[model samples]
Target: MNKVVVKKIEDKEIVWFKNSNSYLVLEPIAAAILLKINKNNSLEEIKTWAFKKITAPKKVVKKFIEDIFLLYTVNNTLKKEVQNNSGTYKIPTKYYSEKYYSIHNCIFKIQFQTGFHLLKIHPIFAHLETESQNKFHFNYTIFDDKDFIVFFKNDAFIGKWNKNETHLFEGKLSMHLIIDIYKKPETDWMGVFHASAISNKKESLLFLGDSGNGKSTSLALLNANGFDCIADDFVPIDNKKNMYTYPAAMSIKKKSLKTLLPVYPELKNAVEYHFKKMNKTVRYLPPKNINYHLKLKCKALVFIKYNIEVELEINSISKIDAFQQLIPDSWISPLEKNVSVFLEWFLELPCYQLTYSNNLKMIETVTKIFNNDL
Candidate 1:
């Protein structure tokens, strides 16, 4: 059932919030269309309501519902909801299945069902198969010699890719392969960068770095110590220019876990390589004062490099240069119109670089920076 409790966010529009915090604002008619489909109303009742109140043609209402369903599928948040609605068949229904594969911190989930191949996904990935599906010059099929193939609609692939021993399903897709996908010509055009972000209040800190420069490990250290995580690997900035933080319930691998063990004592007995290809296993500790809806205004850009010393050095960097490096890592293409809006949001933020060795020194350095300057 559609969650159709529309509230007036501002005088001009009504907003609908989903359980996952994803929302859509609608005009009066769209709101009415949505309201008619709320859990309280049956499908027949909804059609009756639409026929009476909607001045738009029946086709328009049908299109709206179809588009809504597609959006729900692409977002993947509908899976559990759809599962619950199985007996009703209240709307057209589809099934989804995913399989997990191994290859380091990378995780990929391939989703497929009996009917049309609608690929539901978590937002962390850049779709290589979709490259051939661009609107300007769409190709329904993508092939890699005789070994692999993928199919699509528009720029979003709606089919599967298969290779020996490699299966894609509904979990985290291999992040290693996902990362590699970002380097291909597809990603070269789509653009992928390396950055880590943390948010508090309305401010976010994007940590930019090259591979193996310790971005993920530093994020783990910060998470273990005190900082709340916005993203471990990537932050998806929507085309609307709004930035959202996707949180993962996993630990990062580091050369030293002792640096974190003292802060998160439960980690002392936590399992190793517990599931998937995740190398280090650390128990999740609830953030002390954080909630999922906490939205931070991006405040800083920190370029980090790991050192083995006992000291920390923090310095300012040029915002112009920082933007150049930071925008690419954004999970969504910043070149999109809305992305420019996000770029503006990011540029207004402060930028810095932290060079540190040892966990204590790194914590001390960040603490001082937060207390004194940030």
Candidate 2:
């Protein structure tokens, strides 16, 4: 999230700015010219390069350089108003179900307007539920706004999700809790990845890929066998590069049901829910062996996949390729401090792709990674 990654398509190059999480697409010549630009290079030098390179006039390259080049690596200032409402949904007349959870030392009181709203949330924190309490650090009210579900954090509008977007709503809610539990504003977080993370007490490895990569299934299997799951789907890091434990349950997809049943037999009786947008039928497996207080240094980033008949293969991958796939699925803080930390942190870690069909080899491979034997 902190690199100016350049990936070449057939002819166009995608230039992505880690600072702003924005990108520009240009022809190879322009990309090469602009990428070669140095802050200290005088305007004349750029004009000379442009003349020899793209052969464009130096006449108006000044405006192009000042406007476009300057914007190529824009640094977005922190917004004073971070949560801009797309639309408003008023509080409901009544809430029927309520619960409280204590995550890392932070307590949250959530009152759901209906059981359906409760179902979207309560399953994940059923393990962390505490006794009824009128006082808490954060008050969240979930409304069953028709066609949309609205959320309020301490009476301030958080956001709304369409009825079909309960999954997105759950993810966003967890993010707000992460900010609260750490006692920091959203800007203070380094980044949050749509990845699964597992730790072995000393260090952590992040599993990232497109959907159907078996990232979360690997986490469930490893957690059932040996490793500890620190977070799933929505993994966050701080300015210190510590990946904290996220307490939500891991969703077990229908495709992996047979593979995981032998390990977690209770899944046979677990309720299955379908998400049409994602085309996934999943069962929520309550996270096991979570430290709750644990935060580990990230050891590596592994892009993983599982095939029915393929042998195990794991190898290093280009960071540029990895970042391109990662940025679209992640939320990296735009604040300069987090940006700086993310860049420095990413540069130091080794990136790998692990493809496997044999679960035994997969487990052994991840263990060796944690032990630095790989």
Candidate 3:
């Protein structure tokens, strides 16, 4: 197996250009692997080096590599890179919060803020990096061969981890921080919808479709061409009705290459197959305006359908019918017993069901709707 090289780019992202066209956003475990392998170290040397650094048993180092590789296989999209034996590099951190944890094709870092009962990943704005740059927000006293805990300012929450239960608490606490602390607030402040939000300057278009309906593919194609990609799989809309965006960019699948090739011929070889479940996958973030936040209402909703016979047709559906079609695709569902809030939010926006055959003409058809204000 060849050693892969890792380089630190931007402030948060780590790049491994040799493996795949896209960058692998590192978790602490991945970062630790990179630190173990410098440019000169061979695979055997890496095993020996790991044993030297930590006073573990002889087989610990070998198993460590194997276990981490398995993790990447099951939970990570970088499984192909590891399988290909492309030498990889990682940036290590002692303790980081999962809220700021941006894994390759899986999650997004919504917001990183400190509270009385929360653990944080990034520095608290500024002020204390010089004091103890390695210090963490929460007091994480647990350790697996691959996991580390950073202490947080939340004294009460930190106290929950009794000695025997510390490891379990570390995983639980990270999850709690992400859901109760980060996602709950962000979802309220910005209504987090499970749809792709694509925009130019004047008009922002949203594609609300059932899973595997090419929601992510359409967004990726638009992004590759010229328009801004707000969010590939999930969109964030503010309380005052402004939509904020985050970067979770990926690419289209190889199977769908025929649909996209007519519109954008550049993605021929660029189409990489990701085994993960996300319909919209970011293979690379080429030079394009990544819209971090967009203050636009849900101007138009287009339901996308792909087939061989139908030419691209964007028809105007009645408001009631539009709401019925769009509701099913929303993050909130009628299946949930309590859906008042979701129905309220849904009524405020305009909706459309766009039916089309698998041709490139849908782009122009949708463009005309925006022009006509239908």
Candidate 4:
């Protein structure tokens, strides 16, 4: 009997580590070994069992199995949920740069203590920046506190981000915005996906891939062709499974310069920012034709890649494999009910692995998907 929730999807199994609010996708043999982990299974026995399942260096395999066993099979508690609460740290509000934005008709006044923190988030929402004499629904303040970058929602202490972990900072802000826009608590969100998403007005198509796998570049291409960019980097899906709009700029990489040059000629002279921590150079491209209040059902989950070796190919991938790729990079709800909803919505979605080299054909295939032609 496994202590965690293990669901079989095709050839892989997703092991839910509820204690840590985490998940692990395993190969069959690893899954078998993981289920059997306990004091009863000796170190040598588990390592020997792991040997029969996969091919690797004996010393490497032994170390890998030993680490896994010690991490889970031992009495040591599994990795717990990391809290980002701001404890004992306080900073005065300077609000040097202030702007107001309206999302879903809700006004939010965003204030930055310095321009450094402002540029991290301001560019994407620049289009939404507006002048308001009306009362703000919330005041989001971000400031550098020497050791960490702190965030506040309506002056209430929420959380702070580690200096090295800027993604956590932006991600938390994105979630807070989602909560404010939907008028729901943080737990109401089904999941936040680390993917670039675009829509055809009626519905959406979410592109999931590792960083530098052409997710944002594909979005910039599609936006030029026909689709509307919904969200980039952080996409939120509600409990009902509808994908809401996240008004943010598309961070296009330097390698995509020649490819998108024809579509966006102005990008040649666009200011570039080097994200040193992430080791990626990017330029922000504002989204176009987006519906400010649109909430759309997704039509497909595409794991895209720009492969110069091949012309173009779009193939159906196993939902299990897709979930394995998805779960690790995503933030799923810890609540049991919301987890159930996430699984239900995820399993039903059509998953595809799209590899393309030709721009026109890639756009055509995506258009066909939106039209339900494929």
Local distance difference test values of all predictions, in order: 0.47, 0.80, 0.48, 0.82
Q: Distance from true position, residue 356, model 2, in Å? A: 0.6
> In candidate 1, what are the lDDT values of residues 1-374, reduced to their tens digit?
34433544233333333433333445666665555544445656666766787678898876776565444345335346312222322211233533332212233333343212332232222211222111222212222324433433233533344544233422113232333322222222222234666654455666778766777667767766668776655454333333344444333344446656666676566544432432433343322332445445555667888877636788888654565465444443323333334445554666788888766777676666566554
**TM agreement with the true structure for every prediction:** 0.47, 0.81, 0.47, 0.82
Model 4 C-alpha RMSD vs. true structure (Å) is 4.8
Tens digits of per-residue lDDT, candidate 2, 316-345, equal: 988766766777788777565666677677
- CA deviation > 4 Å runs, candidate 4: 1-3, 26-87, 132-134, 265-270
- Candidate no. 4 TM-score: 0.82
Shift of residue 264 alpha carbon in model 2, Å: 1.2
Q: For model 4, what is the error of residue 179's alpha carbon versus the real structure, in angstroms, after optimal superposition?
A: 1.1
- Give the per-residue lDDT digits (tens) of candidate 3, residues 187-283: 3542346577777766677787776677767776666655677665556554555665544443455656766677666666453434343444423
Q: Could you tell which candidate, 2 or 4, scores higher by lDDT? A: 4
Best by lDDT: 4
Per-residue error (Å), model 1, residue 363: 2.8
**TM-score of candidate 3 versus the correct structure, residues matched by position:** 0.47
Off by over 4 Å in 2: 1-20, 23-45, 52-90, 114-116, 144-148, 161-169
RMSD of each: 18.4, 5.0, 22.3, 4.8
Greater lDDT among 1 and 4 belongs to 4
313-349, model 4: which lDDT tens digit per residue? Answer: 9999988778879987899987767777887787788
Task: For candidate 3, give the lDDT.
Answer: 0.48
